[model samples]
Every structure is written in structure tokens, then in C-alpha cells.
Target: MSAWDRTTSREQVLTRIRKLAEIGKISDTGVSRLAMTPLDRQAVELARQWMKEAGMSVRLDAAGNLIGRLESPVAPDAPVLMLGSHLDTQPYAGRFDGIIGVLGAIEAVHAFVSEGLVPQRPIEVVAFSDEEGCRFNKGIFGSRAMVGRLEEGELERVDGDGITRSEALSIFGGDSARLDEAKYAKGSIAAYLELHIEQGPVLESLDAACGLVTGISGPLWLTVELHGFAGHAGSVPMSMRRDALAGAARIIAGLQDLVRAEAGTPAVGTAGTLQLFPGSRNIIPERVQFTIDLRDMDMERRNRLEAKLRELIDEVAADNGLTYSIREDTNSPPRYCDPELMDVIRLEANGMGLQLPELMSGPFHDALALSYACPYAMIFVRSKDGISHNPQEYSSADDIAEGVELLYRTMRSLALSIQGERSGGKWESTTA
Candidate 1:
């Protein structure tokens, strides 16, 4: 039997997930482990213990990222192959969103040790911090810091309770002032791999056990303001009134129409937050502000959609007699999966007799941030009903096991290939 087959059992994996889920258990049904919270710290401590038990050296980075390192006996200074995912959870998030990836990685390393196999490159599993952004309203804090992309001003960002990110980092045992120490130099990491739930319905709808991510969609956030003259609701004639809310509504409708037209494509748009000035029933809305979140896997298509939305907004403002302003808050470009890493996943799935479908992730992940520093790839298990970010999010144990097995196989293959490249020998797939 293969080392993958000899890894931890499905029940063991589920048990670990359950233990982590209990850390921030908000109710009978959900978890609330926001980053830098007491529960978040507890979860990290537990992960540190697990990593130690797996025979790896573990430490917390300056950004509070939990990193477990297993050095290769032959080549201790080789570029590390990194694995794992975020440990933070959304508000009332389900148990499996980020938990599975971290635990699965620990299990993979344990399997490797159990088989007494040593590769040429070190393996590092990192459970990144603040991925949900529920507390500070900014995501990928740890990964961004690791790549040296974190802005200094971001450390001063205050949460709902007025705790600055730096303060929270200090409480969580991280030195925000020393985040530069967390940055990994170029060529320090060979690649990054993560196994997470699909968080969507595509794989479940097709009854597939796993998916190979093609790319991660990047989100473009826009804050739009429409201004018009406030009029008395009872005295103003419908034709004479310049209603900002009405103009905002038209623009939102247009956005929906445009997104619908591009439904089968990678484009998606959402107007999740809106506010009207003087929110009174009898007052005409003089100003309206709304947030638009648009995402796409292709940067060209995403930019085109942005242009089309701007054009539609201009038309809506002109037709409604309202002056409009748009401010782009964020524009994150899409991260395509590394082709060679993707092929390794595909070949491993085929070797294991598992059906792995290719799918683009609509939701962003830590892997997207890691892509800036190294070649990154992800594997996704099917989520039940494609639900995520909710207490109802779920994936079956059988499917989770399949994903973990695939992850182990992929890591094993990468290790062998790294060793082969170092020794000037052809790499052979262990799965074959």
C-alpha cells in the first residue's frame, strides 16, 4: 500500500476538524474564530502542537502566521515547498472552510514521516492569519506580509471595536513593526499548495469528488455616489424631481442585467451595500451611495466589464439628472494556476482513479496572495449544496478524505520531482 493509503483515517481528519470547530463555537451550529481573537490564538496553539507531534519544527511568523517546517535530510537549504491555508473563519462560518486545508497538510507531513521518506526540499505548512477580514475588514494579512505587499498604513486600520490591527497583532504575539522579517526572499519557496472546499455548487452538482482550480477570480470594488436635489416628497411632481435613489436603483438594475448577460462567462457582480441620505419615507433621497463588487478570472474581461458598468452608470446619471462619482477601492488582478503544478494534480488524480474536474474559483483565497511570491495551485473538495460562509456549509467525510489523499499524492510527487531536478535525474510519478 502507498504512503497516501497509510495516512490518517477519514474519522481522524474529521475529528481534528471538529476539535478546531469547537474553539470558537458561537452556538450549536457555527464558529466565530475571527483573526487575533482569543479563539484564533487558541486554534493556532493547537495547530502548533499538531505540527510538533508530526515531527516538524513550528514557529509563528511576525504576522502571526503559523509555520511548520520539516527539513529534508539531504538538502536542508533547498527551496521549501509550502502547503496549508488560512485558519481564520468568517462570522458564523462553517467548520470546514479553512480548517480542512491546514489539518490535511499536517496529516500529509505525518504520512511522509510515517513512511520514513526524505526528499531534497523542505516542506512547510503555514496556517495564514486574518484571511476572512471579519475583524479588520482587510483580508490576506499574513500572506500579504509574507510577500512584502502589506502597506504600513494597513497596520493602523481599526476594527469595529476600535482596536488597531497592530494592537491586535501584538495581542496575538506578532510584532507588527517587524512584519518585514516575515517577508520571504525570492526563490526561497519552490511552490505553494492548498486543499480547500470548493465553496460553490459546481463540483457537487456534477457529483465530482474533487476539483483542480484553474484560477482565482479577482474582485474590483467600486464606491459610487449619486447626487441630486432633495425635494419634498408630497409637493414635487414626478417629472420635476431629481431623485438620487432612483438613479442608483437604475444603475444597480443595469449592473444585474449586464452580469446576467455574461452569466455563462467568468464575470460576476454584486451590489451588497447601499445607503441613502435622509432615509426617510417622506423625503426625496438627495444622495445615494452603493458598493459594487465585480469579479472575473480573466483580467481583460474584468476590465471590459468595469468599462461597461461605468458607461451604464454615466447613462443612468444623465437620464436621471443626477451627478455621479465613482471611486475604485480595490482592483485585485486574477491569479492563474501554475501549469506544471496543475498537471501534477491532474496526473495524481488520474493515478488514484479519482475524477478531478477543472473549475475556476469565484471566491478569493490565500493562494491568490501567495501567487505573488511563488507558483501556487489549489485542490478543492465538493461542498454540499455549494454553501459557504455560513453555518450550513458542509462537505461529506468521504469527499474530504478523497481530497486529502489527492493532496498527499501531489505533495509526494512534487517532493520527488524536486529531488530529481536536484540530482539531474528524470522524476517518476509515484502514483504510476
Candidate 2:
């Protein structure tokens, strides 16, 4: 018999995934639940119901994080074991990006409860809000708030519809005024674990069903705006016209050249979004705004590339006679998974007769945010074609089941093992 056949409810997990997909579902398979929207709240409510059924005491924190706690009879006040991923999807996204993680964790906890064996520490499953960051231009809002990592003026940031994050949080049943109350005291969390789709082609290429995350390459998000004089396209001369969009195009292309030079490494750069003022067929573009996403596992290399990219932007703007401004939206350094947790997962996978490949995640997860507060690890289910944040993203049921089984085993080990001590502000696990 297979190792997961008796533990996790694969069918039940899949059912809940399907049900949640139907909430803000766009295409037959696409989901559009942006953060803090009414549709996102509906999905949160559904997950809350499932958490209740799992014998958890659930609550929505002031930062809009949906948390479900399973108290440990042995040490109710001890540091809690947290497992979760976000539920918010990109504007045009697939069904399983962050959905499976939350559902899979709930299933793992439910299975644990069914055994009637008390854990050594409390367990909490969280569905972090705004992990997608499509609406407010900031991701991991919920997780960051929990760790007191929020920046000033975040509540004032406006979305496309002119709705501030503060207003949206209020409508979603969150009180930003009491956000400090949601912050978890240091050492209050023993560790964090997240299960998510690979979101890249690594596992499928290796023919592995599940992989272990070595570390996350946090992205540097920047918004650049260029200004120039607007004129009639027909009247603007080829050499004399100062076109902001032209300058933006050159900088975007130059960014590609900068990152591609470091080929064979994890370095990557993208200008995913762009906008132009007076956007007309005949009007010369006066202003252009675009976003930059630069990531690398190596901090020095990433910083170097960022400097070069900035220089490229300056050169382009000068050549085009355009003035520009840049705003740093988010700058997160790389975060590694705990060695102790990785060892636990490795042992669990070995016992299940599964081969787990170790890979670095190019895309960050909520685990990256929680990594600041506690030791964290991630289990990645094979993503078909390595496609994510799109309608075509998918992972097989068998693969997801395998990943969840590993998570369940890992959670059980950490939750029931002898408690660890906090040394030098880090949780040092004594468990093998």
C-alpha cells in the first residue's frame, strides 16, 4: 500500500480545492480573487468553515490573516507550530497556486486530530491575505504584519480603483487600527511550514513528484516613471521627439541584457507591468510607468545587476530627454529554510520511499515572510509544465497527495517532539 493512502484524505482535499476554485473563478479554470475583495472574503469564509470542521479555533486577525488553531493539551502556551500558504490568486491565475497549501495543511491537521493523539505544541493553519499583491501593489501583507515587518504608508497605498488598503481591510472585516495586536511575539512561533506548487519547471523536469525548497530568492520590486513632452504622433520628428515610452522600452530591453549575461544562474529580471499617459494611436506618449522585478539567490550579484539596471535606466532617460523617478516597492533579501526542518522532511520522504529533489524557489512564498519570525520550510508539489500564476497552472492529484503526506509527517514530528530552546533569537530544534 502507498504511504499516503491511509493518512491524508486526497479526495477531500481535492473536493475543497474544486469548491474554492468556484468562488471567483474567471475562465473554466482561471481564478481572479484579488486581495481583500468581496470575492476573496467569500473564499476566506469557506476556508474558515473547513477549519472549524477540523476541530480548530479559528479567527480572522486585524491584518486579515485567517488563522485556525488546534491547541495542544500537553503545552497549550508553548510556541505554536504554523502551517499555511496564501489563498489569494493573481488577476489571471490557476486553481492551485496557493489554494492547495492551505487545504493540504488543513487535511494534515484533520488527520492528526482523527488519531486523538495530543501534540506537544499548538498548531495553527493560516491563509495569509494579499499574498498576490495585485490590488495594492504589495504582497505578503498578512504574513509581514504578523512579524511586525510592515512599512509606513502601506495602509495609504491606493489600488486601481482608488481604494486604500486601510479601507479594503475594513470592508474585509479587518481592523488596521488594531494591527499591532496581531503581531506574534518573538519566539511565540516554533516554526512554519508551507506546501505549494513548484511554480516553475524544476520538479517536472526532474521527474519528481515533490521537492524540498532550499531557499527563496526574494525579489526587489521597483516602479519607474518617465516623463516627456506629449505631441501629435504624426507631427513628432523621429530624432527630435522625446517619447517616454521609447525610453521605457530601451530600459526594459537593457534589463534583459543585464540578467541574461548571468545565464546558468538563478538571476532573472522582468518589467511585468507598464502604463502610458495620453495613450492614443496618434498621440506621442508623454509619460510611461513600469515595474521592475529583479531576483537572485546571490545577494551581491543581484545588487550588482540592480545597479547596472539603474544605470541603464538613467542612460535611456537622458538619451530620450526624459525625466524619471523610481520608487522601491519591496526589497526582501534571500531567506533559507531551516536545516533541521529540511532534515525532518528528508527523513519522512525516505520512509515513504519517495525521492525528493532539492531546489531553490525563484518565486517567493509566504514562507519567506514567516522566515523572519521563525525557522520555516516548504514542500513543493510538481507543477505541470512549471506554469503558475496562469489559468493553465496545474498539479496532479497524486503529486499533491504526496506533498501533503510529507507535510503531515513533518508537522507531526515537529509538533510532538520535545520542545526546543530559543538561542540567540533563533529557534534551535533539539529534534533529529
Candidate 3:
């Protein structure tokens, strides 16, 4: 049997993720498991038990991340290695996104336990909270809090139906005290590793099993409100009207044009929402509000795009003689994982006979927030058709196991390097 086969079976990883999906499962091509909901609570509980079964003691921190720790043969706070991903999903999320990371971490621990394989450093597995941000109005809510990025009173942010943060978190444990306990002490972490599905078609299309990401994009969410007159739709002359909707319409069109011009290929913009004040059948929309999401992995490019988008909003708003103001819903700085760490992951994959693709991630992830706190890197298993945030998202059993095997090797390598067990600077040689 191969090293991968010896530690964890391909079928076992798939079975775990598929089974996690089946519980509180939905098939609308959308995953309805929101944060702290009954489904969400159940899934975390299930994985927590699995972590325990893998011979690691488990606990939930103030950030709601599930932590499983293995004692190092060395000592207390011995340089630690962290692995795992988020457990939350989109309103309609697929099976693998975050769950795969959690389960793979479990398997890695199981591998370590079964073989009595103790690297010089201790390893920890964590399942992050609210990574998908499908519920409670904030994605990565759980992670932001851990790194101390989430400010005081910010937890009061509201959701679509006016649901407050307190109300949302209440479903999980209803204790603010517990929430504070979830935070990671600054400087306590040695390094962080997250294994997640590619959530895109790149690896599958390339016939590769894993992607070594160099960077994860930062996200800028903008809300534009256009002010104008709401008059009778029928009697209003097109020439005399200052339609907020019309102004909003031009801005919307401009958004697409701007997105095309600026983001031509990998750059992306989404206007996922629009609202009118009265929303009446005959009322000329006097007020129109819309949302735009802009993302770029390159910080310079991301900043440029944000500045240009703001400039366009001003220009577009002015052309229609409409007053407009933009409210920033969220802004997460772009994250570039340590290239030194990325090279290690790639080397492990190549050593395991898997071709690794260098890629950039478009989605905003909890990893970015954690990156601010420590050295972070990720392994992406392929998703079918580049699909994510929906039920159609998928990764084959074989692909997931390959990603896990790669993570296992990398973790072992990092552990050795941290403990001074490995002599050379890095793992550069590969047999394959």
C-alpha cells in the first residue's frame, strides 16, 4: 500500500464528507445549512465527536472554531501545526467546501495516532465558524473574531430580516461569555494550514488532483443608493423625470461595463441585490439601492479596482444628476500565503506523484483573516465545473483523498522543519 493508502483510505474521506452533506441535507442545488442553525450545530457536534475519536481532545474557542489538539513529545506550547477549515456553508452550499477540510484533518490525526507517528511538533485541527457567511450577514465572522479584526459592538450587525447578531449566535450557545473564550491568544500559533475543495473546476479540468494556491483574494462589498424622484410612471415624461431607478439603472449598466473592462478575465463583479423604496407597480422608483461585490487577489490591483469603481460610481451618479452614496458592507485585505509554505505543499504533492497547479483563489475565505495572525497556506481539491456556493459543487472521492495525502505529507514536513529535525532549509527535492 502507498503512504496515503496506509494512513487514510480514499473511500473513507469521501464517505465522511458525503455523510456530512447527507445530514440535514438538501438537494435544491443549494446548501441551506446556515451558521448556528440546528443543522449547523448538529454538523459541528458530529465532527467534534470525530475529532475525539481520532484520539485528540476537542474544544470550541470563542470564535466557535472546533479545536483538536495532540500533545507533542516535546513540551507545552511546543511549536504547533494547525489544520482544518470552516464548517458553515452557503444558504445553498455544496457538500465539500468546508467539511472536507475538517474531515481531512481528522483523518490526518487518525493516521498519526494509528502509526504512533509523532512528528517533533504538535498538530492541531480546527473547523472554523461562519466561513461561508451564508447566514447572519457576515462571511468569515468566526475567523475575523479570532484574529481580533472584528471590533467591539460589531457583533450587533443585522441580517436580511433584521435578525441581530445576538439572536443568530443565541441559537448556538446564547452566551457572550463563551464567544469571547473562542478567541486564539495572539502569537500562540506556529503556523496554519487549511485543506479545502477548489470550489472551482480548474484542477478537474486540468486532470490534476490538487491546486497549490499562492494567494486568496480580498473582498470589497459596496452598496450604492441612488436618490431621485418617485412620480407616476404613466404621466412622467422621460425627459422631465429624475428616476432613481434610471440613475441606478445607468450605474448598473456601468457596473457590467466596468466589470468587463477592468476585470476582463479573472476579475469579477457581482450585483447580487437591488431594492426600490416603494416597490410598487406604478410608482416611478424615486430611490434605488443596489449591492456590488469586487474581488482581486493582487492587493495593488484590488485597490486600483476599488478606487476605479468608486470613481465610476461618482461619474455614473453625476451623469444622471442623482445623489449617490456608497456604504461599505465589508472589506477584507487580499491574502498572499507564505510562498515558502506554498512551495513546501507543492513539493509534497509532486513527491506523492500528483501534479500541482499554481492558482489564485477568487472567493473570500476565513483563511485570509487568519493569515493576518500567522503563516497560512491551503490545499484545494478540485470541484466539478468550478461550481461553489450551490449544491452543484462537487469533488470526486479520489481527488479529495489526493488532496488529503498531500496535506499529510506537508504537515509532517513542516512539523519536522519547526522542530529542527530536518537539516536543510526546505523540502525541495521530489522523486516524481
Candidate 4:
């Protein structure tokens, strides 16, 4: 606790998390604050107040991102050092999934200014919109928009409630038509940093409270649809049945075997969602739609498995007398963290008497999108039982403080090092 005395306050960080958790509270610890909803806006306003109290000029960008700027007194026009994650949560998410990152960043900047230290480059704390993407089925909306990586027809995407993304943005105080204006210019961000829960058991199993991320293993998202003839379940003979759900089930089960083939590797796949048309007890399923999530640290291996998966789908569809189609929703290559930035983090952690285990993140974060715009890195706090995206997700306050303290120290060091002159609004790299 005394280690955090110089900068971050463990109680303050935990208190804020508790308050935010009550906004969309469900069961005991579950939250359902989906993006662009009234609850999400309320949460943003609360976070906005905290940012303002931390001495930042805040605004909501055209892309629905809430940004708090702490302009450097020395180089006001220099490229900024950005820190943040998303505020929106999954339908049945825990409070700490994306909450700690935003609050920890605010705490870091708050402590920095309180110490009377001024940065060379401006620093911004952002709560990016819709990183969960559960509502619109497209995650990282705000980050992608800022990096100028948004896909075509993104605004037209609809949610389950039939609200278009354009409409949601407008209602959330953003101008959908002006999203292009929200893009940060090339080199506008000197670097990006984020803190998040491990969402896996690796850290806990290794007896570590905090870890350094080596990189993010990108996810390949796909939606597969199978169509076949429908008939009475009991009347249709098993051999003559044309069952789409059966075909889907086989593909989903086979997917597990396919990824398992690459034993001892980080390769993995999941069919987390599925829907059967005419879902009646006695009706043969005529259509089935499901989602596929595949990930691997090695792209070549992932690609090889993907080909095998497609072949499995083809075979299943043919044997079931079904026609199938696979739609690629997202295909992102793995993005590695900056080595120099990792050195900065490692040095800071060492000073704090921490030996953080380096690991690759299987779940993508806002940092994944920021990677395209500038150098990016991440710090991970240990998750209890490695649970996330669910009500039971938990991280100890002590462990979180350790992560935040490290983040504060790393940010402070980087901010001070960037102090000096600027070249065409971009600060020169000091860590040669």
C-alpha cells in the first residue's frame, strides 16, 4: 500500500470502480451497460466528471469517444501519448473488464498533475465507445474510427433493437456523418498504452499479480449459415433427414478437433453463438446460423486451421444435404507491442519490486486498434479464476493497485522524457 503512496491511490481506484459498477448492476456483480444506451451515457458522464477533476479538458469526439486532454505546458502542439480502453460492457459482463483501464489512466494523470510535473507532449485519456461490439456485432468501433480503419457501411450496421449505428451515434452526442473528421492524423499519437484484466488463468497459475503483454493475438470472426429442407421430426426417417442444425453441430464439434490438432500451441477456436430456424420441438431445423471465433499467435498456423475448418463445413453440409455459406466479419493479424515501451514498463515494474511475466493477450482490446495508429503496449492485472465477460469476473484490489502503480510510473517517465522541443508537431523519440 505504501508503494502506491507516491502516486496512485488504491482506494480511490477501487472506489470509482464500485461506483461505476452500480450504474448498470444486474445480479450481484453483473453489468449490462451496452454502448450508445442511456446507461452507457450516464457512465460516461460520471467518468467525465472524474477526468475534469483530474485537470483535463474533455470532449466527446464525432465517433462517440469520450476524450480528456491534459495539454503539456511545454509542447502544447506535440503528438499526444494516449491511454485508455472502452467503457461499454458485454450484456452480462463484470465491472472490471474495461473499467480499470479507464479509471487507472485517469488516476495516473491525476497523480502526475498533482506532483506538479508537466509532460512534453499532451496526454489524453479516452473511454473508447463500443469496444464490446455485442450490440452492433462490430467491436472496436471508436478506436477503428480514430485510426481511420473503419470498414465501409459500418454506420449502417444494426443492433438487435433495430437501431442503426448512425442513429445510435447521433443520440449519443456524436455526428455520424462527421466520423471521418474524428480520425487522428498520421503520427498524431506518439504511443498508446492500456491496462486490462488477463481474462485467463495464466497469471494466477504462475503466481503473478501483474504481467507485461508481448502482443495481441488477433481474432478471426466468421458467421456461418446452413440451409436445408424442413420436415416433421418424427415422420422424417433419420437417413432421409436434411437437418441444418445437425450439420452446424458437426462443424462446431469438428472445429474443436481441428484446433486441437495443433497440440501444445496457442491455437484455439470457439462457436460461442448459434441459432436454429423454426426452433420447435417437433420441427426439423431448416436453417442454422452460428459464429466462429478463431485465434493464434502464429498467423500461418491459424490460416492452415481455417482452411481445414472450411473443408469440414463443406463436408458436413454435403452429407446433410445442406447448402452453406461463410461470411468473414473480421480478419486481423497479430500486433506486437513496442520493445522500447516494454523496456520502459519493465524498468518501472522492477523499481516497484515486481518481476512481471511477459505473455501474449488472447482477447483483443482497444490497444489492438491503436496499434495501427502508433506503437502500443499493455499491462495486465491478474483475474480471479480467469473469469471475464461474466458476473463472476474478479480482480483483487492489491493486484490492481500493483498494475496501476506500474502504469503511473511508466506514464510519468515517458511523459517527462518527451519534454523538450517538437518537430512538425511530433516529439522526437528519446529512447534510441
Cα lDDT of all candidates, in order? 0.89, 0.91, 0.76, 0.91
After superposition, candidate 4 runs with Cα above 4 Å error? 1-8, 223-251, 274-290, 311-327, 419-432
lDDT string, candidate 3, 1-432, tens digits: 224563345666777776687666778445677777778888889888889988999887665677888878765566577887877777777888888888888887787677666655678898877777655655787777777777777568777778777676766754555666666787776778888888777787788878888788777898989887788989988877767887777767776776688643466778889998888889888888999988776667767767877887787667766788899988877788887788788767777878898777887677788798888998888888888877888777777878888887887677655533353534332222
Residues 1-432, candidate 2: write the lDDT tens digits: 122444339888989989999999998989999999999999999999999998999999999999999998878899899999989999999999989999999988888888775888899999999998889988899999999999999999999989999999999999999999889999999899999999999899999999999999978999999999999898778899899998998999899998999988889999999999989988889999999999988899999999998899889889999999999998979898999889889988998899999988998888988999999999999999989889999999999888888998888777767653444543334444
The sequence of per-residue lDDT tens digits that candidate 1 reaches over residues 236-337 is 999898899999998899899988988778788999999999889999999999999999998898888889999999998898889989999999888899
Question: What local lDDT does model 3 show for residue 270?
Answer: 84
Clashing pairs for model 1 are: none
Candidate 2 residue pairs in clash (backbone atoms < 3 Å): none
Candidate 4 lDDT at 335 equals 92
Deviation (Å) of 236 in candidate 2: 12
What's the ranking of the predictions by lDDT, best on top?
A: 4, 2, 1, 3
In model 3, the worst 10-residue window by lDDT is 423-432
Using TM-score as the measure, the top candidate is 1
In model 1, the worst 10-residue window by lDDT is: 423-432
Q: Name the lDDT of candidate 2.
A: 0.91
**Candidate 4, 113-220: lDDT as tens digits:** 888877978999999999999999989999999999898998999999899999999999999889988999998898999999999998999999999999999789
Please, what's the RMSD in Å of model 3?
A: 3.7
How much is 196 displaced in model 4, in angstroms?
A: 1.0
Q: Where does candidate 3 stray beyond 4 Å?
A: 6-8, 27-32, 154-175, 178-180, 231-238, 263-265, 277-284, 419-432
How accurate locally is residue 269 in candidate 2, as Cα lDDT from 0 to 100?
95
